[model samples]
Target chain A: MAVVVMGDVVQLLQRQPGEEGPISDALLLAALANGDGNALAELYLRHHLKVYRFLARMAPLDQSHLDDMVQNTFLAVRQGAHRFKGNASVQSWLLAVAANILKQHIRKESRRRAIAAALTEIPLETTTDETPEARLARQNSMRLLGKRLHGMSHKLKTVFIMCDLEGISGSEVAAVLNLRQGTVWRRLHDARKQLRVALAEYMEVDT
Target chain B: MTRCPGKEQLTRAISNDSSAELDAHLMECPVCRDECEKTRKLIEMAKGLPDGHPTSQTVTRIADELRATRPERDLWASARPGYGVVLVAFLLVGAAVFAWNYVFYPPSGPSGSANTNAERRDSPKGNVTASRSAIYTHSIEHKGYAFDEVVSLREGTVTIQVTPLKSNERFMVKTDDATVEVRGTVFTVVATNGRLVKVSVKSGKVHVRPKHADVAILTAGGQWRRRTHPIQKPTAVLPHSPDSGVFPIASPEAASHLTKKTDRLDRTDKTVPAPMKKKETVFQEGWSLLRKKRYAEAANVFDNAVSSSNGKDLNEEIYFWRAAAHYKSNQSEKTGEALTDFMRRYPQSPRMDEARMMYGWHLFNTGRYETAKQEFESVRQSPLPHVRQNAGLGLRRIEARQ
Candidate 1:
């Protein structure tokens, strides 16, 4: 990959798709620091899916809540764009900011009813061969899994979601959580063990 | 066979770490193998949950929110490192130009005359619109970037319309017997017979301080007039005594100096009905010098009266004027001493509000901001609105410095 200088980044951003190499996150963030709304829009287009999936794994947000969380995360991105030191990847920085927003929201909205409603709303993936009964069973099991995930401590749950579910690297998870890599792996192991015991009955039925 | 890997180790293996030894053990031990499989199956189920990607409309909503809340562009953000220095230098130069125009070369009356009777004279601080027959000397006294527009009226009527004075700016109208101070107001002062006879407020408020009386606040449509009394003959000069009546006596030296002005004092004596006594007419003499801005001489007269005076209320008035004189003459040490004594002795004095405000500025000019802030805060409760406003201005000055 060529080293995209500041001038090249703007030119590339201006160009239509399939013209040059993809713009780096750091360059997009630099544009964001300059108060370019286009950079934020581009960043959202490229990364909103990943951000949404990450939040869904951590918390059961309804469509409205999910939209608000993503909007707030990007808002934080816009505000703190100048503070990015390029020490970590943009994805890690984003996840760190998202984690903070998520924790704050959860603290403010402590009612279990919202989380329960979200558990039932988790979309089910089905195949043509799947029967109605099997689909219902799978949906119930998924709901139970989401409930259990929500039930875990926030620390253990975030580590599990970032590491195992989202496949974020252990080091990246550590950076996002501001912990040692060893601590991150330790929490991941603990989270999985807790989930294993809690889901032992469901596993037996699946087998 | 190796001991079966614990659940924590199995979870780790199923998550990120899959060591060769662990793999061999898992292959050899069915118990461990089944446990790891179950964990893997559970993990797969959790991972298989839908991503629930947001819709285009949701992204659009987020973009709209970002656009709505986006801060204005930061000029220096995109500039190269060296450009910041140049930008800051330019800003500094611009500030210097502004300070020079408004602070150093402040606008003055026509012909550079301090006593101009033009219908209106404009200044950055405020404007002075005087009557054609108005006999007044207008001067701007600078206190750093701030100033006071002092209009001393010897006689005749002057109608002054002043703009809102800045924290450091003051506007005042002074006569021999009265001083009208304001932050900003349109008011007219009529001085005759060596006295401010009548003051009427057209807009805003003014504090009218009549000699030997409490300060009076006059708002729009409010007017204060000195009580009309028959002009009497000057009192016969006698030895200094504490039994003097409405007529203030001066020391022998002060009496000789003030003898020529005795007729003016007698004519301007609006406060009446009491018999005259001794000849130490120091208060009236000092007050006359103060009205002429001869602050050093006035302070000297007041200083002598402060020791020789016997009446409590008379002493209070003398102490206040003495400190005020020292302050105006820029005698820092004497002002501090006089103000301290005045504040200490007359904490409950009717003139305490003005005393505190004066002390507040004296402390502020000398860099005692903490105590100055307290003094101004105390003056914030003054009954006179204009005095309270001046105190507010003083507080703002302290805040800006801090």
Candidate 2:
């Protein structure tokens, strides 16, 4: 388990106030819990863009599935509001839930694919020439990384994503993943090493 | 040949304290210099993906969906009418309805009248008839409070209107298999078929204890559903306290005074409430780690903050900090995930505008450009001028690329 050390956190906490009042979240939560329609709307207004974009990144670019997952995630939060303990940041916990939801979606998709494989004819692959060269290159890199990400061990990949991709501090990653700070550091180092090795061939192509 | 810094040391040196020793090493060693440049390039390359934005249509659709699926208010309305009277009224009304239906639309099978009568007579406080055909009636009373009640439980559902004996004082009802605890509040508990228990806390806190499980406290506007058996696992109980002995349900004034005294006592001793103290320490630690650019470590601190407290305020703060740390560390996937989570968890957070901006940036970095542009465009509509300005800048950047 990674313990986020005390001294490092204090510095971040000392930054300029992003927003004011400690009681605001509680008040908003209370309103939501009470089934205040306006409160729920207000909450949506505040977070809709962020959550929608996040889902779009994680899922397919198609709006239907992305919208459904995002909607379901919010619905779950609304239903599970009371169970929320103010332990982790509301965002991290929600992300955990979203991640879980994504995992479930992947599992369901895999199952659907398996069922389809058993019952339907296979489709042939087709290449597209519509994307620009630069765009194609960028897409290739993202696809390569995404595929490689799935092959890495859970802990290593999570640390890599949290630190290198998401910009979370090693300590914060430790807290979210419940690993020690040192372990988070070690895993991050190992993950980067693995990625470097695994993507070496791909990087050569780019160069 | 020159000394080459280990990966961890180099990473720490890049993100942590800028010491002269590390600087000196970097200045002297070509290997370290090359490694540093490579690391920088890797980070930049990873972050260079095209951004995307959620369309306005998507945003509107989500808002509409949220409005549609929000929980009904009827759940909390159960707690207000004074427990005893509500219970009695429910019993009377239910019996009338059941008798009317039973007589007018009797099932086409032999009914066990004797057993049903016996269950009706003996079922109250501490006893339940296990037979599938049995209907149980149970009641408990706290007399000095604003409300008192004798609740009748038929099957597994309970109707309650118990008043709070004191502010912040909790009135917990425990059964052999489950407990529905209430405070100065009104609520209802429906334990369907002895397998699942549903609780709606209209006001105050409702703590549910099922058999051997540690108590789960739910506040006003909160509801909980749990299985009777699995949650009874042994690892749930908190350590017993000397002050854990049952206190008489006192008047609201007395309860408030007692609560204050307890707070004072808790303060005098270093034994701060676990939830509050946990938040302070975790927040402090998480913030410090974030400032040092040790994002992984900061995230861990935020995680501890969520696990140690039930306060919504702390949870929201932790989410914001975690999002910031993820963004700073350049973990686009995790950054987006954290922002999404923050939005879902604290949709009403005042810092939502900032979260939206970052989320859009994460999407863009991950090569989801159209989605990023949409998010930025939405931000352009914000009431806050600064937010709108930033959103406009983001939108222009996205559009200009195409």
Candidate 3:
């Protein structure tokens, strides 16, 4: 066999005959569980962006922290691959693990007693379509919302973020959080009420 | 408006859990209707939050870490030399260990009362505790390593008191249930009846993972539990003191010095006068050769030392090194004979306990489980914690094998 390095293989990127389209996330994870390095690379390429965005929203983390969390979530997937029972979608499972990792990190840093406000400096301009004034309004609302979340308990904030903001269904939130659906709805309601009181000035005065 | 359906039910209604009473209130009361519309708008506003994504550094780091942690079996198999080479290497390590014990502490005959003091001076007297209820505390403080902490891993239902230390060090304590990691913290771990491992931190923090449970980082006043039959939810508790103490031992500093000396001796310049014919010089040359891993040359040097009349005075030490060199040269029978002779002639030797422990391991490796068990039991009462721990692990390994 000839010696081959990572760069030399890039020129041979064409798919071999009969190799089907993009593999399903679950199947790629299953192959990863079998220690297939290629499957791991493919899986990371597919889900790293979605996971990174989720982690950034999940905690008040810097760029390094966001990068580490994404890497940790995938590394965790590799370690716990055999334990992936497939009860939730692989992406949902990854997000839940990322959330738990944040919780542990917060707990270790002695900030569990109080949420570190704006733990994130979320850059607000994600779309070019919105006018500058409109983007500023959204940024202020999010910044105010982040502060309001800091005052709320972890449970209520997680339920609110997943259900009202991320748009995950209440039942799915229950599965991700190991809580009852009624409990999820109740927390979401509590979170929403707190935000209403905290952001009434912004609410009464439109952007 | 008769107090609208309680806050709980109103909250429930936001998720569309419409009770008849709430629906009637919304229909009849304009105030309640306006509140519901405002609440709905609040959720919509939150949903409009901008997306956040990370840079490509995350992907590259993940790939590199995955590659680094790949299983070592493939590399191990591919790196092997021929069968002859492996047999020779194993013999070398076994003999080297044996020679290390003998040369480091030469034997003392029955009347050598003066020699007993030398042995006593080398004995490591750090700390020892009675394993009452199968739970006890052991303090580990190594200034050389990042270890100036005391952590305990207890099996069975026993309460141990651990005192806080004033240093920056980390250490790991393990039992059947979990491994507890401590870094300059005071904590206690208890395993109840060999079925569970429980860790409670009084100050600082500790990382613990039960064999089949989640990794938990426990802060001061936090407790973690892993059980064969888990029932109670793992949670935090207020910190409390049971009992704690400190025992000062200077072994860590001495060990650091020993390591530095060994490194110096092991380096070879390969320019020495031909093997010294004088008996004393022969032993010195043999020791130097062994340090360099020149096993065959060392074996010949030690053999020459033993044959000379002066060798009689240091036969126990010479025999130990001779056995080591033979083992290193893959001469198993000669190695066994040398060890047996040393054991019989110097029963009161300072290294008798260590020899027995090594012989037990040799027996265990050669499938003589019964003899190995006996050898391990003989040294089960060794005062050294490290030796006792090794013996305990060895016993458990045998039982597991069976």
Candidate 4:
């Protein structure tokens, strides 16, 4: 599966699988475990966006921490590559690591916040195309979304994000979370019920 | 209406895990259908929020860090099943021998005893002593008094007195902030919050290298300390101070003048009463507070000094130091105000480049990218190579983020 030894990963990935061109994610991970830096870079280019998006949604309170979280996720991938047993897809494994790191970072941030109650509040990022009213509405919606997500329990949040938003299967998420499939379905139910109530309130407020 | 499908069934259907039974129920029951639709729309709203797409610089930084670090070796990946059996047998045998020796030959010497607080040797008695707050350990090899040892003090203080060592010997006391390399000297080091706060030599000389500063040789009765950021390399060494008994070193000229004045005071006034102690200047008081990391109090003192100043240079220093105190203490509003005031009052200050870079990062972090870009652009023209390089990186980061 490790065919292209010295060429660009993008070129290699673009070719058909039957033509001895594309490397599988597992093959790249095997090379990474074998200390191949090129394989690591390839895997990063392939999956960084997914990992970044997951962590961004998970830790919506601080957009700045996304970069650090992504970096740490890939670093964890390199360190834990050998332990990948193929029970779940590589994307599932990557998200699991990203989720763990996000949890740790949130815990640390909470402790810091307790010690120093006030942190400098950075202004929200603004796009030139957004009008004042639209911007306000968007900002309010996002703020409410972040608030609800942040308020949810970590388990419910992880399950909802993985199953509902990222579209990973419940079984894949169960393996990543080390929980039974039944528990995952149960948590997803609770998460949906809570979010539905929130959505009702939000729609009422909007009208 | 008939009891709707269970919560798990509804969740599965919403997540597109549709079965024939759940589909028939959702088709018939309007309540379940409405619930599913609203929940799906809520999930859609969540998916619509913008992802925190990282800049390319973050990717490059992580790649660089990964390249610099070596991956941990996985030993079992290549090991044969027979190898594990053999390894377990070997470990069992080794453990038996160790256990036999540990029980039968229960060690008796001072070198053999392990204490929770201190470590020592029989021959080199009283060489290392530490307070309860200090955590340390020591080991002596069979190199014939060529003692090569290290004491790691994570925090607190440790005092060491070692005899003159052979050319091959090496001894060091490492702290969070600095390393004190002993040349067979007697010295004390106090570290707090992961930085060396004080180092005093008693009988011989020691070379101290603060993690962020240059190496400095300090002789007996000489002392060194870190009072602020980027602790400057010492150019002039001297005894402790008379007023506070702690020397606060700055530039070479300042250290030299203070040394001479301290020497004259010691030589002429050997019998001066304690009540005749000279009062400390406002700057000195504020400086002492800063050294103690009492940043809020130090900022207040510097603010007072700024208003009462009589000279241009001193006034500039006061304003700059006040801004620094505000920055260190995380008083964001006060920090911005002080930096703005300093830049307006002293446009030609020597430290303006540093101030601009600091303010640039402050603005950048606060999402004021345009103003941050201007600050960084101005700093990029600095004569200092490091400052210019940092400013260039800052500009690149701003461009990437925008």
Tens-digit lDDT string for candidate 2 (A1-207): 222122123112222457565434434444565565555666667766555544433433345666677677766666655554444555554555565565577567664464334222212123475457755655665555544554566557656655665566666656656678788778877877776676676666765
Candidate 4 residues lying further than 4 Å off, grouped into runs, are A1-21, A61-64, A109-138, A197-200, B1-3, B64-69, B75-402
lDDT (Cα, tens digit) per residue for candidate 4, span B1-402:
456888777888999887888888888898899878778778877887667677788778776776667787656855689999999999999998777545543322345563222232345422888889886666554343234567777777888887765454477877766788886788988777555777888988888877665567788888776644223332211111112322222432233332222211111111232342212356566666776778889888887666665334355556766776776666778878888988998887766776787677667656788998999899888765545865777788788877
**lDDT on C-alpha atoms for all candidate structures:** 0.72, 0.55, 0.60, 0.69
TM-score of 2: 0.36
Q: Write the per-residue lDDT of candidate 3 for residues B222-316, one digit (tens) a residue.
A: 87654221112111110110111111111212222322222111101112334434654666666567657677788887776666664566645
> Top lDDT: which candidate number?
1
Ranking by DockQ: 4, 1, 3, 2
**Docking quality class, candidate 2:** incorrect
lDDT of 2 at A197: 71
Ranked by TM-score, top first? 4, 1, 3, 2
Taking the tens digit of each residue's C-alpha lDDT, what string does model 2 give over B224-331?
665322111111111111123111212212223322222111111122234547665676677667546577787767756665564464746677777766666666
After superposition, the stretches of candidate 1 with alpha carbons farther than 4 Å from their true spots are A1-20, A85-87, A110-113, A120-123, A126-128, B1-9, B64-69, B72-402
The residue ranges of model 2 lying beyond 4 angstroms of the native Cα positions read A1-40, A56-61, A80-89, A109-139, A150-156, A202-207, B1-7, B12-24, B50-52, B72-402
i-RMS of candidate 3: 4.4
What TM-score fits each model? 0.42, 0.36, 0.37, 0.44
TM-score of chain A of 1: 0.82
| Candidate 3 regions with alpha-carbon error over 4 angstroms | A1-22, A108-122, A126-139, B1-36, B56-402
Cα-based lDDT at residue A23, candidate 1: 73
